[model samples]
Target: MAGGGGITPIESGIIEYAIFIVLLPMLAFPIILFLGHIFNGNQTWVKSA
Candidate 1:
């Protein structure tokens, strides 16, 4: 099941999941910021971390 980028279907799926794994933690920052704003809180320190 070869596709574009020379990646097989299995390899593409693995890569997609791996990217999601890596990005999931990085997405926490924005979620924290949004939640903070809703609670009338500030997250200046979270931005630095």
Candidate 2:
């Protein structure tokens, strides 16, 4: 396991968690921007930037 013999369940779970952790921020930013635009069409925070 430590020397890369076979894939362990714990190792797979860690990879899954790592993928989710990396993706969440990427997903959240777009969703938040869309929601903010929808809710505040005229006063969008993104417009100032």
Candidate 3:
């Protein structure tokens, strides 16, 4: 990629976008999991005797 007054390395650009692509799921997973539990009404699968 080209920048003002300089050239940006292609590898660096790819890695920068890759960081967001990889990071988004990593950050969202925990948030989604917690939200699911809260919305799930605290139910468990196993039947209690």
Highest TM-score scorer: 2
Per-residue alpha-carbon lDDT of model 3 for 19-38, expressed as tens digits? Answer: 78888999999999998887
After superposition, candidate 3 runs with Cα above 4 Å error: 1-12, 42-49
TM-score of 2: 0.53
Candidates arranged by lDDT, highest first: 2, 3, 1
- Where does the lowest 10-residue lDDT sum fall in candidate 1? 40-49
Indicate whether candidate 2 or candidate 3 has the larger TM-score: 2
The TM-scores, one per candidate, come to: 0.38, 0.53, 0.50
Instruction: Give the better candidate number (1 or 3) by lDDT.
Output: 3
Error of 3 at 14 (Å): 3.7
lDDT of 1 by residue, 1-49 (tens): 7556776789988977998787988999899988877866456545534
Cα deviation at 4, candidate 2, in Å, is 11
Worst-scoring 10-residue span by lDDT in model 3: 40-49
All models: lDDT?
0.77, 0.83, 0.78
Query: Per model, how many backbone clashes are there?
Result: 0, 0, 0
Q: After superposition, which runs of candidate 2 have C-alpha atoms over 4 Å from their true positions?
A: 1-8, 41-49
Q: Could you give candidate 2's per-residue lDDT for residues 1-49 as a string of tens digits?
A: 4586889999999987898888999999999999877878565454654
Error of 2 at 49 (Å): 26
